[model samples]
Target: MGFLGFLRRSRHERTGYELYGAAVAAARDPYFYTGLGVPDTLDGRFDLVGLHAFLVIRRLQGLPEPGPALAQALFDAMFNDMDVNLREMGVGDLAVGKKVRAMWEAFHGRAAAYQAAMKAGDSGALAAALERNVWRGTPAGAAAAELARIALAQDTHLARQDLATLARGAVAFLPAARAVA
Candidate 1:
């Protein structure tokens, strides 16, 4: 790759990082924990991030050429951040890769389940998956239902957003209060 190619690639990676940051911000909204009863633990946080990231990836998949490439960049950005986070948390160097790999598999599993449920327009299925993963099968159906609703709303909102703006790494998620309401 030439200088321009390198610059172009870096630009996409930066955009991906920006987009991932936005997803993390959305996931950190207090409404999820206080209002919806999602646990305020590391696994819960990871689940929220994975959920939001999956939503963005799903939207990106529906776009054209650059869409797929951007989606790959986004995925790469997410895992890279996870790796950094593990190291920062004092996970040993040798264990970090294994931990990250487990997280990667977990993310893919949850994403697939969510995608299938959403594609079928089955809120119950979505809630079931959320309850299982986010609540660890502790029977949080009502809370999971609320989360499922928010996820559906987010998906609809993202679908209508201008693709060009999203491609530039600017995403606006629905307001937490409004979404939870």
Candidate 2:
């Protein structure tokens, strides 16, 4: 993280950090864990973050200019955070890579499922995906429905956002007003 750090200091990189932070914040909202019964475990938190990040990265898809680069930066920030978390959890340095790879696979699979649902404009499909990935088949009751509503709304909201704002590392997430505990 010395001189090599200079390579990571672009606007896209900065924007990625900002967006990822926003995603983490959204995931950490108490409603998701308490109301939605998201387990409040490490796997639960990762699923929430992965869900949120997928929304943002999906928004950046197919956009010209800084969109792709910013998305890639956001991805890097996520994996970097993952690396730090694993280390902090007492994972030996040698085993971190394998664990992270597993995480990457899970995230990638989730993203693919979400993308297909979004492309099909199918709420049921999205909810099914969430049921498997986020809820782990336990069923979150009304809160699960609320999360699906939130994701669709957030996706629409993010789509309406100006690229200039996103390029500056600025993202505004909609409130979870539709869902209550």
Candidate 3:
């Protein structure tokens, strides 16, 4: 199906298993993996998680079909890798932990809402949700929003391209942070 058509499909009407399957398939794809820069080893762990999260978001958005087992594997890998990377990045303290957790919760909550709207076949709602979750009021969010707009303008067929660009921007933030440090 086309991207808009795919987005309009309901997750509940489908099945967690089916969604999970798609995620898994997407996760295993070389193109997806390379786009996210998944390492052969567990080193640079946080980068891995960031990449996995990027991929997982795409998967949830209906980009692939690998199955639940692979999806679970990717999720576990991402969580473990992120924890290690966060500590190394100096987010080891409780305060930072709480903040990061809050950000994560907020992002995921919005993502779920976006998925629901997409499933319901509401293009307007889906676009609005993506704007709110990924764009809405922050510099980073604004950039993402602009990218999303460009992607949507192409008829939603550019999800992978848009996601790659988003991932690159996100990864770029780390280097910029390091330079400042």
Candidate 4:
């Protein structure tokens, strides 16, 4: 099947398990690994990030009312993975670390508000949350933007230049993107 066909068929699954399985399979295969330049080692955190990204996309597509705690957990997972990559690359001393942390906290706060709005069926609140601090200029913002694009299929709304810059940064730190793609 074509890529779009796979996505459509996968979306039809009634349970998250099927979607999660497909996502994990995709993440493990060389197709995604080569595209993202992720290492084959089980210890590589990028693989986990990729899997979580797929899971988040599936959950959002299913429109399941994931509680605030669940959302927070996912956010924390992604943030932690990015932090690990940053530290390994010796970016811990850069101001980018502080900026990235602040951006993550802001994103988490907005995401919680968004989840509450979703549960309340409050469109206004959702819109407001989306509008506020959706993209801060930091590594976390780039990761969040990538996740948002993956989850929402709304890539056009993200800052492309910033995303590219962040992707380059990640590639430099991870040393896999250059080799993968």
The TM-scores of all predictions, comma-separated, are 0.93, 0.91, 0.41, 0.33
TM-score, candidate 3, is 0.41
Q: What C-alpha lDDT do the candidate models reach, one value each?
A: 0.91, 0.85, 0.40, 0.39
Q: Indicate the TM-score of model 4.
A: 0.33
Q: What digit string (tens of lDDT, one per residue) describes model 2 on residues 90-164?
A: 999999999999999999999999899889988888888887888888876666667777889989888988788
**Which regions of candidate 3 are displaced past 4 Å?**
1-66, 93-100, 138-181
lDDT for each residue of candidate 1 in 136-171, tens digit (9 for 90 to 100) = 899897889989999999999999977798888999
In the range 25-136, model 4's lDDT, one tens digit per residue, is: 4345453234433344533333343433433442343333442223334444455555765677677557657956774665456556655654575655544443343322
Please state every model's RMSD to the true fold in angstroms. 2.6, 2.1, 14.4, 15.8
What is the lDDT for 155 in model 1? 95
In candidate 2, what residue range of length 10 has the lowest lDDT sum?
A: 172-181
Give the lDDT ranking, best first.
1, 2, 3, 4
Kindly give the stretch of ten consecutive residues in candidate 4 with the minimal lDDT sum.
167-176
For TM-score, candidate 2 versus 3, the one ahead is: 2
Position 134, candidate 3: lDDT: 38
Top candidate, metric TM-score: 1
Error of 3 at 23 (Å): 10
